[model samples]
Target: MNPILSNLRNITLTYAIWLMIGCLLAALLVLTNISLWANALLFAVPSTLVFGSISASAYYVARSLPMKKRSFFVVAGVFGGTALIYGIIWGILCFFWNKITLLFDESWAGIEMNQHLASLLLICGTLLYLLSILVYDVLLALDNIRQAERREAASEMLARDAELQVLRTQINPHFLFNSLNSISALTTIDAAGARDMTIELAQFFRQTLALSEQQKIALSDEIALCNHFLTIEKIRFGKKLQVQMRIDPDSENCLLPPMLLQPLLENAIKHGIRDLVDGGTIELSSKVRAPWLFVAIDNPVDTQPSSAQGTGTGLKNLQARLRSLYGDKSRVEWRIAEQVFRIEITLPLERS
Candidate 1:
C-alpha cells in the first residue's frame, strides 16, 4: 500500500512537471489568438495525455535497449509507436466526444469523425504522428541518459558494500589471533587479569560479530566500536598503551562506512606500540574544513623493536575499504619520520 501511494505520488509529480513544459509550448498557441484559458486547457489536455504515455513508453524502451547502440533503432521505435498510437486515440476522442456531448447535452456542432473522413484523418494523423514522434524522441533520449546515470550509481554502491564486507572479515581474525596470543602469554603468572582480559575480549568479539554485516554506520556508532576495540587492547597493554582522542566537533554527527577506522588503529597498536619494550602514544584527531573532514591517527614507532615487520596484511584491506567509500572524495595514507608513524584520512563530512 505504501509503495503504491509512493508510485502514484511520483507519477503525479512527473505529470505536473510535463504539463508545465506543455504550458510553455502552449504560449505559442495563445499567440495565434487561442484564448488564454482555452489554450491552457487544450494545450495541457493533449500534452498531458500524450506525455504520460510517452514517458511510460520511453521507460520500457530504455530498460530493454542494449547499451551498445543506444542512440538509434529501439528509441526511435518506442517514440514512433507512441506518437502513432496516441495520435489515433486523440483523433477518435476529438470526433466522438463532441457527438456524445451534442446528443446527450444538446450542445452546438463540433468537429466530427466518421467512416467517410476516416481515411483522410488517418493520413493527416500519420503526418502529425511522425512530427510528434520526432519531438518525443528528444524526451526519450533524455530519459535514457538519466536511467544510465542511476544504474551507474547503483553499481558503484554495490562495489563499495562488497569492499567494506571484505575489510570487516579481515578485522575479526587479526584481532582474535592477537588477543589469543596475549591470553596465552598472560595465563602462566597473572591468571586473574588474564581471566578478566578474556571477558573483555569476549565483549569485543561480541561487538565485532554483531557488526560483521553492516556496511555503513553513524560516526558516533563507529566510534563506539572503536572504543570497544580499545577496551580489549587496554586490558592487555595496561598503562603502556596510551590512547588519546581529539575528534572534531562536527564529525561525531556524521555517518560513515562501518569498521573504517578500527583497522588503522589496530595496525598502529600492533606495529607501532606493542612491539616495543616501552609502548608509545596513539592520538586520534579530526577537523572539518569545507570540502572534507580530516581524521588522523598518529603513534610513535620504534624502529629497533623485537618485531620489525613493515606494512603488512590489514594495510591493503584498509586501503580497499577507503577506496570503496570515498572513491575520488576520500584518502588514507601512512607516513613515517622521526620515529613517528601517522595515518591520515579525509572523508566527506555528512550527517545521517
Candidate 2:
C-alpha cells in the first residue's frame, strides 16, 4: 500500500489542497482563453485526481533515499521516473477527453488545444510531485532522529546495570572473608558461640542472596539486612559491640539501591569499632525531608593511629555507586572530630 493511502487523514488533507490548486489552474485556463469554462472544469477534475494519486508514490521514493547516504544519482533517478510516469498518464487522459469532446460538439472540432497550455499543465503536475517528495523527506529525517535517541538511552541503561552488578559482586567477597576469619578464631575457645554464629551467618547469607537480585529495595528491608549483619558481628564482639538505631517510620518505605548501606556499616565496624579497645557504640539514623531521604552512621574512633584503619576503597565505591544511580542529586560525606567518626548520606526519596 502507498504510505499516503495507508493514512486516511493525510490522503484526505492532500486531496483537499490539490483540489483547491486544480480550481485555480482551471480558472487560469479559462482566463487565457485556452478552453471554455465548462471544458476547463472537465479537464481539471480528472487531471487533478490522476496527478494526486501519482504524487503519493513519492513517499516510497523518499523511503529509499536515506538521509545518511543520499546521492545525486538516486534523487535524480526518482524525480525522472516520476516525471515520465506523470507524462504518460497525462497524455492518455487528454487524448480521451479531446475525442469525447469532439464527439459531443462539432464546434469543439474546430478548436485545437494550444501546445503551450499543454506544456504548462505537465510542468505544474511535475512540480506538485516534487513538493510532495520534499515533505516526506523532512518527516523521514525527524523519525530517524527519534529512533537514534531511543537507542542511545537504551545503551546507557544497559551500561549502568552492568556497572551496578560489578559493584554488588565486590561487596560479597569482602564481607565473607572477614566473617570467615572471625568464625575461625571462635571455633576453638568458644564452640557453642561459634556454632550459633554459623547458624546466623547461614541465614544472613540466604537473605543477602535473595535481595541481591533486586536493583532497589525499601529502606526498612535494607535496615533489616544491616541488622542481620550486625547480629553476625555481635557474635564475634559480644558485649563490646553496641548498636543504636533511630529510624523515622515515615522514611521506612522509601526505596534505595540494594546493598547500599552494608558497605558503610562494615566500614564503621572495621575502622572505628574494631580499633577501639572497649569496642564503642555504632549509631544509625534515617529521616525523610520531602523529596530527600537522609541517613547517618556515627561510631567512636580511637584517637591514636592504628594499623586497622580503613584503606578507603569501600568509601570510594559507595560514592561512585551513589553518583551512578542518582547523578549529582545524591551524596555521601564523612567527618572525624573529637574521637567520633560520622558518615552522612542523602538520597532522593522514591516510593516503591
Candidate 3:
C-alpha cells in the first residue's frame, strides 16, 4: 500500500469520531432552539466537509515547516492564514445555503436570515475549522514519529550488514596468511601433507565463500566449516592437535551469524595450541538454554606463557560482529586460568 494511503486508512476511526462530534454539535444547536433541525443539518454537514478539506492543507504545511525550524511567527501565520481562508469560504457557503433554504420556508427565511445569525455561524465555522487544523497537526506529529522510527530501523540494518562484511573480510586475510606460512613450512618436510593441506584449503575457502553470502546459518553447518578448518590444521600438526566435541543435538539446528565461531577457534589454535611442544587439546561444546545458545571453546596453554603476546584482533572483531548483529543480546567472553584458555559466546537462538 502507498504509505500516505495506509496512514489515512489507519486514522479512519479518528475521522469518524470527529465527524460524530460535528453531528452532536448540530443536534445541540437544534435542541437548544438556536436553529431548526433542517437548518442545523444543512449548516453543520457542509461546515464539517469544508473543515475536513481545508484541514488536509495541514499535511503540506507540516512538510514545509519542519519541527526543527518551526517558530512562533511561522505557526501563527499558518493557523491565521488557514482560519481566514476558511472563514471567507465558509461564510459564502452559509450565505448561499441560507438564501436557498429561505426560499423553501418563508418562516425560516425571516428567523435565520439576519446579520447576528450570519456573524455567529461564521464565527462557529472558523473555530471548528481551526479545531480541524489542530487535529491535522496531531496526525502530522504521529506520522513524523512513525517515519523516523522506520528510517532508524533501516539505518541500523544497513550498519549491521556493513559491520558483518568488514568482520568477515578481516578473517580471510589473517587466516590466509597463517595458512600460507604453515604450507611454506610443511612443503620441504612433507610434500604429500602440504599437497593435502592445499587441497583442503581450497575446499575450505569454497565453503567459506558459499557461507559468506548468508547472514545466518544452522549451527551444524558452522561446525562443519570449523571441522574443515581443523582438518587443514591437523595435516600440519598430525596427532599433536587433538579436538573434542560435545555439542548438544538440540543446538545443532539453532541459527547463528555465519562464520561466527570460526575466529574463536582460530584464536584458540594460534594462542593456545600452536605454541605448545605437544599441541594441546581443543574442546568445542554447545548447548541451548531456552532463548540462548551457549558455545565454548577451551584449549590447554603452555605452563610458561609465551613472551610474545597476541594482539587479540580476532576476538575484538568477533565481539564487534556480535554487538552489530544482536546489540546487547549477545556477548563473547574470554578467561585464562590454570594453563587453560577458554572463550565463551552466548547468542540468541533463532531457527526456521
TM-scores for all predictions: 0.64, 0.87, 0.88
How does each model score on lDDT?
Answer: 0.67, 0.82, 0.80
Between 1 and 2, whose lDDT is larger?
A: 2
Q: Which 10 consecutive positions of candidate 2 have the poorest summed lDDT? A: 106-115
Residues 34-124, model 2: lDDT tens digits = 7776677667766677677777777887787777776788778876677656665665566566667667675433225666866776677
Residue lDDT tens for model 1, 1-352: 1111248786676667656755654564356443354533453345445644443443443345555666666657765676567557655654554454446432232323356445544444445555544444455667669988999999988877776766776776777887788888889877887898899888766776665566666677777888887877787788889989998777887767777788778888888887767888899888878767788899988877654675567778776776777777787788998999988877877777
lDDT value for candidate 1?
0.67
What is the C-alpha lDDT profile of model 3 across 1-352, one tens digit per residue? Answer: 2223357664585467557756875797777677876667766665565555555555565556677888999888987677767776777776776677667765543235567666766777667667766666777788889999999999989988888888888987888999998899999999999999999999999988888898889999999999999999999989889999999999999999888877778878888898899898999999999899999999999888688778988888888888888889998888889899889999998974
Error of 1 at 346 (Å): 1.1
- Which wins on TM-score, candidate 1 or candidate 3? 3
TM-score for predicted model 2 compared with the true structure: 0.87
Quote the positional error of residue 26 for candidate 2 in Å: 3.9
Q: All predictions: root-mean-square deviation over Cα?
A: 7.5, 3.2, 3.0
Model 1 clash pairs are none
In model 3, the Cα lDDT at residue 290 comes to 89
Query: In candidate 3, residue 279 scores what lDDT?
Result: 91
lDDT, model 3, position 109: 39
